[model samples]
Target: MKLATYLDGSRDGQLVVVSRDLSQAHFANGIATRLQQVLDDWAFMAPQLEELSISLNHGRCRHAFAFNPAQCMAPLPRAYGWTVPEDGGRRASDALLGPHAPLRLLADPVPCAARYAVLHGDVPRGIDALSARDAIRLLLLAAESPTHTAFAPVAVSPDELGAAWQNGRVMLPVLAMHNGRREGGTDKPEPGADFGRLLSDLAHPRALRAGSLVGATTAVLVPAMAAGDAVRFEVKDEAGHSIFGAIEQDVVLEGTATE
Candidate 1:
């Protein structure tokens, strides 16, 4: 079966596309539907859920259980808190999400256009029978993308969000790359004209001024850059210093440009 998944890191729900045998399916799962019911759903406990593992043949790994938040036989609304930034970069803002925040899926599930059955469960294993909801719930519990890096989405301009609404909040695709500029250092240069020194002038803040968007991992998302358009950024450091300057690249926004 071929499975394609779409995740909006900013939002809690996920969409999976599956193709198997000669069928296709689409599924959606979010914290609201699955987590809340787990608070008291004993039928989903580890004892029963463990049976699903038998299909895998090979045993699971250390991080296996950690892969799905929906699978734990714990309780309803199983507060799967805030996951830290995975990029291993600086987390310099107090506005970060807390660990217990909820993940919300924004839509419903439907059969896919491919040849696959949409099975869902917390444990990763093949199954012959699964309801549309159960499959997504389980997939939410079991699936993980090792390459999925978590990032904080920031807006470049208000129009980004405006355009996003018109696009059904599905076309905010962006490219990320390291800005390659070091923060601070020493040395000497022309009075107020040191280009290298001027680089660190950008501050790391939550609500930065208009233009570019920088994340905790230093991953930069460039929005729109046409030749000759003046690129600008306002850096407000931990000390609340605002250094306004022309940025090296166009501003980039993350996730649905709208929210």
Candidate 2:
């Protein structure tokens, strides 16, 4: 099932269930209002949302509407914590930007492709890698800027990925575009450090809170983005269907007229 958070002028946006083809959606109104609420009680909430997803995808929903990435926020507007692998296994916390949100920067910043997983529930300390894998609820594509990271339009469940999801890593190329032109991309390969092992290592020190975001950057590199430049990142299945929509943003200088 695919899920998204619609921007509703609140810290936590309204949760919506998106269709498989990324065309339609229905408010997760009665079932749940916020993504964090669903994450907090995933075992209870996820199944209900999944059923709604099926209905929307099959064109059986009565009130489904067009899914708009322009009106989306980060799947979790504000996560309990954001952790990313860096510098020999070091972790850091960062803020998140919504897909299609303008990226404001004071200086030119390199755009990097990223992948992240949203945790379903708290992870217990010293759990094994296999068990850690079970804690992952969904995966997303991301574009990493110096100040903050922006995510794709939706979060996709592992089961929805079919054979593309392999042992906690997505086996797909991360493509990058700069100013509407293809710049560079990372080819499909098994990640050296799968999410399960990363989570397992982190959980050894302390329990990880539910809704925490764990991310990793792909090798795709592009020129530093300047004001008015646009960058986009996406991953596709073998048949060329986008898995998590796309993370597309325009770069604007801080304190400039564009801002």
Candidate 3:
């Protein structure tokens, strides 16, 4: 079942269940009004919301409306912490760090962190004392192409989640960038990794972390950005089932001194 957050003219948009075909939507009016609330209590709320989704598909539920990607927000606008694995220059450029060869911003915020972080969770292994919501959110952005970094929906059962880590094999589909840049174009898309490999890569020490950037990627896409450029990020399916909808603001270099 696909879940999303739509704009209700509020800071935290209202939660809703989107049909598989993306032709319809059912409001989560009674069942946790916010997406984070739903994520916080996903174990108990998902099934209930799924039931409502079934009803909506059958025309039994009320207030079903046409779904629109334009009026959506990131599944989790801000995450507790952020971790971005080293790109190795396979899917991105190494020159993004403006003449700095060593690259000291791994532990700090990068342009991508400020613009794209979408999915959030308790911890790398979900052992944290905080609320347990481990499903990875795919932060979709308005890019020139698809990065294969979007989140694929799956059942969040303990056994299923654990299976993703066993023997370095995962049933989960990891979106990966592929091929090569086509004359100043973005990279292509393909299955990059299973759950085990992705988790391991994300935990790598050389990774970058930000308070707001939440999602994981094999390579950093937004290696660089300027002060005036408005680079937006979002992740949804072909049918527009927004996992993390999109970043609202454009990329702004807040007071980086001119030198």
Candidate 4:
């Protein structure tokens, strides 16, 4: 099931269940108030949210409303921990921006097409690659900027990806658009590293806390983006349907005006 966090003038935001077609949504107020809350007790909470998802997708919910990416916050606005594979993997405690958030840059930085996963529970040390798959709660598309990073509108379960999710790696191409034009050499993008191995590598050093965010850059490359350059990242299925929505943002100087 697809899930998103709507901005509600709060750090955590309000949880919402989104429809399969990305056209509608319903508040998950009674089920859960924030994405992190659900993640903390995923085994018990997810099944309830999944039932609500089925109702919303089937048009059986009377209170469903239109899904708006503009009103969304990063699925987890403030993560307990954030780590990406760089220089033998880097870790940080940071806040993530929403998909529509403007990227403020002190200096021009290259935008990398990336994907990330939210951990469902703490990962034990020395876990095998195959066992690490159980730690993943959901996957998301991301745009990694030097100053900051922003995530797609929603987080999707592995089952939603079908054949594209293979052995802990998403085989689908990540399309990068620069200023409304495609940036890669071809229409399709190159897939990244094996996530299972990436996760296992991360867990080997120490135990990962629940709600930790882990990501890796895909093989697609784009030129450095200066002030006012727009970049968009997304992954589409064979039928041309967006899997995790899109991460679209414009790069702006640090002191510039932004909404």
Residue by residue across 17-47, what tens digits does model 4's lDDT show?
A: 9998889999999989998888888989999
lDDT of 2 at 254: 78
lDDT of 3 by residue, 57-175 (tens): 68787788987655555443333433343333223311221111121222223433321223433234423212222334323222212211222221122232243333322223222
- lDDT (CA) per prediction: 0.22, 0.81, 0.41, 0.81
Q: State the TM-score for model 1.
A: 0.19
Q: What would the per-residue lDDT of candidate 1 be over residues 33-133, giving only the tens digit for each residue? A: 33223323425542232232222223332222212212112111113221212233232222222111221212211110000001112322222222212
Which residues of candidate 1, in runs, are more than 4 Å off? 1-36, 42-44, 57-251, 254-259
lDDT of 1 at 132: 14
The C-alpha RMSD in Å for every predicted model, in order, reads 21.8, 1.9, 10.5, 1.8
Residue 182 lDDT (model 3): 15
TM-score of 2: 0.93
Kindly list the per-residue Cα lDDT of model 2 for residues 178-243, writing each as its tens digit. Answer: 888987754655563588888898899888888888776554666578887888888788888888
- Better candidate number, 1 or 2, judged by TM-score: 2
Which runs of model 2 end up more than 4 angstroms from their true locations? 87-94, 109-111, 190-192, 257-259
Deviation in angstroms for 56 in model 1? Answer: 3.0
Candidate 1, residue 33: Cα displacement in angstroms equals 7.2
